[model samples]
Target: MASSTSYPSYKQLKEDFVSNLSGGTVSEIALVCAVAPVVSLLWSTLQARQSFFKPYTTLGFVVDFLLNVGALLLSVTLYSAVPILLNLLLLTAALFIYALPPNLSRKKPRLLPDAKSRAAASAGSLGVLSTKPFLTNYRGNMMVVTCICILAVDFRLFPRRFAKVETWGTSLMDMGVGSFVFSAGVVAARPVLKERADNKYIPLGQRLVKSLRHSLPLLVLGLVRFLSVKGLDYAEHVTEYGVHWNFFFTLGFLPPFVALFQSALRVIPSYAGLAVLLGVVYQIVLESTSLKSYILVGPRTDLISMNREGIFSFFGYLAIFLAGQDTGMIVLPRTLKARKSGSQWTMLLTLAAWSLGWMVLYHLSTTYKYGAGLTVSRRLANLPYILWVVASNTALVSGFGFVDAIFFPAFYNAHDSKTEKEAYEASTSRILRSYNRNGLVIFLLANLLTGLVNMTVPTLDVSPVATMGILVAYMAVVTATAVGLDMYNISIKL
Candidate 1:
C-alpha cells in the first residue's frame, strides 16, 4: 500500500527518468539490433515451410541459437544497458528490413490474405484502415512477453525506481497490469460484439446467466492459482495483488456485467461511454466507503477485507477493457486492403488525436484528485489510472499502426495486386505470430516457469547481471517452444 504523503518530488521524477534512459550501453544496442532479425527470420522460415529441419531453416536456427547464447554470455559477463533511443531505432530499422525489399533483383515475398486484409479491401480507402482491429494479437503477445520479463527479474536488477511510491502513475508494473487487462478485455468482448449476442431481444437475466456460465473457466483458474500460490509458499510480493486475489477476478467478473448492461439497454453504448460510466460509479464508491482503509491497511480479522483491493479495482479494469473493445470496434475490420499513403497518414493522425485527448483527460483527472489530497492509486485502479491506461495504450497502438501502414504496405495494398504479402509477413515476424497464435499457452507456461524459478533460485539475492542472463535464457526457451508448436500447427486452446 502507498502513502498519500509519500509522493516523490518533481525533481526526483526527472532524475529517475534520466537514469532509466541512460542505463544501456553501445554494445547492448548493437547486439540487440544484430540478433533480432536472425531470430525473426528463423521463425519465419520454419513457419513458412512447416518443416522441423530443412537445410536453410536449420542453418538459420543454428546461427540464431548461437547468437542468443553469445548475447546472453556477453550481457552477463559484461554489463551495459540498452538505451531507450537505441531500442526505438533498432525497432524502426527492423521494420524497414522486414517490410521492404532488400535488393531490386530479389523477388517480393507473397503472403496469404487473412480475414482482416480481405475485409479492409471491401471497406474502401479511409474506411478500410478504420474498420478493422489493428494488430490486436501482436499487441497482446507483447503484453505477455512484458509480463514475463517483469516477473523474471527482481527489483534489485533496476538502477532506478520505475514508479513513485504514492502516485498511481506510469510505472512498468502499473502498465503491465493495464496492458494485460486491456488486452484480455478485447478478447472477451470479441465474440459478443462480432456475434451481436448483446442484442436487447435477449432477457437481461438470461444474458447474465449465460455470461456467468462462460466465465466459469476463469473463476476455476482463479481458485486453482490462489491455492497453488498459497499452498506452495512461492515468493510473495505484497504489492502483487495481495494473497487471496489475482487478475483472474477482474477477468472473470467484468464480461458478464458488460453483457448484462448491453442486454438491458435499448441502444448499445460505445466502449468509451461505458468506461466513463464505470469510472464515475467507481469514484462514487471510493468516496462513500471505507475501501481505502482496507486497501492501504490490512484487515484485523476478515480475510476478504484484506483482499478488497482486487475486488474494488475490478470496475476500473473493466472500464479499461471496455475502452479497448471500443477501439477494436473502430480499428478492426472483418477484412483489410492496401490504401494510399495519404489515407494511411489520415488514419494515423486520427489515432494520435485520440491518444492525446485521453492523455489530457488523465492529467485533468489527476489534478482534480490532488485537490482532495489523493494521488492516483494503481491498487485501487482509480479514474486517473484508467485514463492513463487508455492514453498510453492508444498511443502505443497508434505507433504500431504507423509502422504497419508505412512499412508493411503490402498488407493494405494487396487487394488486386500480385505482391507476396503473406510470404513477406512470414519472413519478417514468424516468432511474434507464433507467440500470438498460442499466447495463452505461453503465458501459462511463463507463470509455471516463474514459480519454478522462484522456488529453486534466490531471485532477489542473485546478481543483477546474472538475473538478466537467466531472464533472456528463460524467454528463449519459451519462444522456442512456442515457435516449434506453431510450426506444427499445434495450438493448446483452453
Candidate 2:
C-alpha cells in the first residue's frame, strides 16, 4: 500500500501556521490523541486474528465504568488536597537517590574455574563462565534508575485533578508521555533482546508481506471503530467512562511504520528532515483554528473529533516514534556488548532532574499553553512546557546512556556486518540482554497501579508530608512488585 498521501512540506507546514490570523482552519485536521493510535492498532490486531477473544480484554474495563462514575462522584464528596499529592511525588524524587545503594557498578562473586574472577576475561578468553550475570546486574541498576524516573518522577509527579483549567494538571500528562519515552527506549535496544534474530531471519520483503498478510484485524478494527464511533457517535460511552478496545487498531500500522522507516532511512539521508516536515505540519494544526480545542484540549465544541486523520496527538506520537526509531538506528550498531559500572547514584541523580523540573514547572505554572498569557489551548503547550520535556529527555539520556555504557561496553567498537552477527548478540549472540522485557505489560501495570492508588487516596485532605510518604510508599511497592516478578521470571515476552 502506498503511504504517499502528499504529506505537507516543512515550508508549507510553517506557512500554514503563520497564515493563521487566529490559528487557521480546522478543515485540515488529522490525528487526535494517544487513543487514536491505540484504536488503529486494536483494529489491526483483531483483523489479524492474533487475538482470540473479541477484544474486551483490559482488566476492570467493563467492571469499572460504574467505578469511574463513582470516582467522579467522589470528587464532589471528598475535600481534596490534590496539590499535596503532587508534592509527595516531588519529595520522593528528591530523596530517591539516597535510598538506593551507593556503588555505581554491578559486581558479583565469580563462580569460576581457573582465572574466572577477572572482569577482563571474556568467556572465550578465559574459557567459559560468561560475564552476562555482571552485565545483567549493571543493566538492572540502570533499569532501576530509569524505573525510579518512571515511578517517582513521571509516574507520581503531577496533580490528579484540576477544576477550571484543562492544562492545570499538565505534569500528569507529562508523566504519561514518559511511558512512551521509556517504551521507545526499550524498542531501540532490540539488539539486547534474548531472541536470536539470525536463526529466525525473515527477509525484509517477507516480513513486510507477513505483516500485511496479518493486517486483517487492522482493516476490521479500523472499520469497526470508524463505524461505531463515526456512524453511531457512541463517544459518550468512550469518554473517560468508556473503553473502545482500540490499541489493536494502532498496533497494526505502527510496526509496519517502524520497519518501513528503518528501510527508508537506510537509503535516505534525511530522516530528521522528514521529522521536521511532519513536526511543522502538526505544529500548524496545533496553532490553527479550534482544532486543538476539540481533539486535544477537550469538550469538543464541534463535531470535529470525527475528522481523525493527520492532525492530532496521534500524528505527534507517530512522528516522535519515527524520530525515535531514526535515533535508534543511529545509536544501536550491531557489535554491542555489556560493561561493568560503579556509577549508579550519579545516573539516578541526573535523571532526578526530570522530577525537580516538573515540580518547579508545576509550582510556577498551572497550564500547558505554549505562548504567553491568556492562551487556553493545552495543545499549544508553552515554551517552558516543551522545554520541560526537553529537559526530561536530557535527564533520561544520563539514565539510558548509563545503562548503555555497561551493557553496550563494545558499543564504540561495533560495525555493521553482512550477517549482522558480529554486530548483534545472542546465546549464540545477544547484547546486554536486560532491556525492557515486558514493556506493554509494565505500561499497563504502571497505569493500573496509578489508577488504583489514586482511586483509594484522599484528596487535598492529606498533609504534604503525609502525601509524600504515601506516594513514595506506593511507588516503591508497585516498582518492587514489578521488579520481583521480573526476577522470578514471570512476565510478558519482551
The 0-to-1 C-alpha lDDT of every candidate, in the order given, reads: 0.57, 0.36
lDDT digits (tens) for residues 336-455 of candidate 2: 332123333333454455446533543343344643222322233333333333334433343344433433333233222211222223111111132244444444454455435434
Tens-digit per-residue lDDT, 1-494, candidate 1: 87678786433443333233212222333343233333333333333334322233656555444433333223222322443343455456445555653333334344366855775465443322222213533353353435344454343564333322233434544665777777666566555555563342556777788888757877777898889977875544444465588877667787687876674234646777878778868877777887666666766356666567777788888889888876666455434333444555666677688888887877677665543333566778888778877887777667556645544454554443223334234334445556666776777777778777766776656786677678767777777887799789898754
Q: Which stretches of candidate 1 lie over 4 Å from their true place?
A: 1-82, 88-101, 105-141, 163-169, 196-210, 264-268, 298-300, 334-346, 368-374, 416-424
Q: Against the hidden reference, what TM-scores do the models get?
A: 0.73, 0.45
Regions of model 2 farther than 4 Å from truth = 1-172, 175-179, 189-253, 285-311, 334-391, 399-435, 453-473
How many clashes in each candidate?
Answer: 31, 56
In terms of lDDT, the best-performing candidate is 1
Cα distance off (Å), candidate 1, residue 366: 1.5
lDDT of 1: 0.57
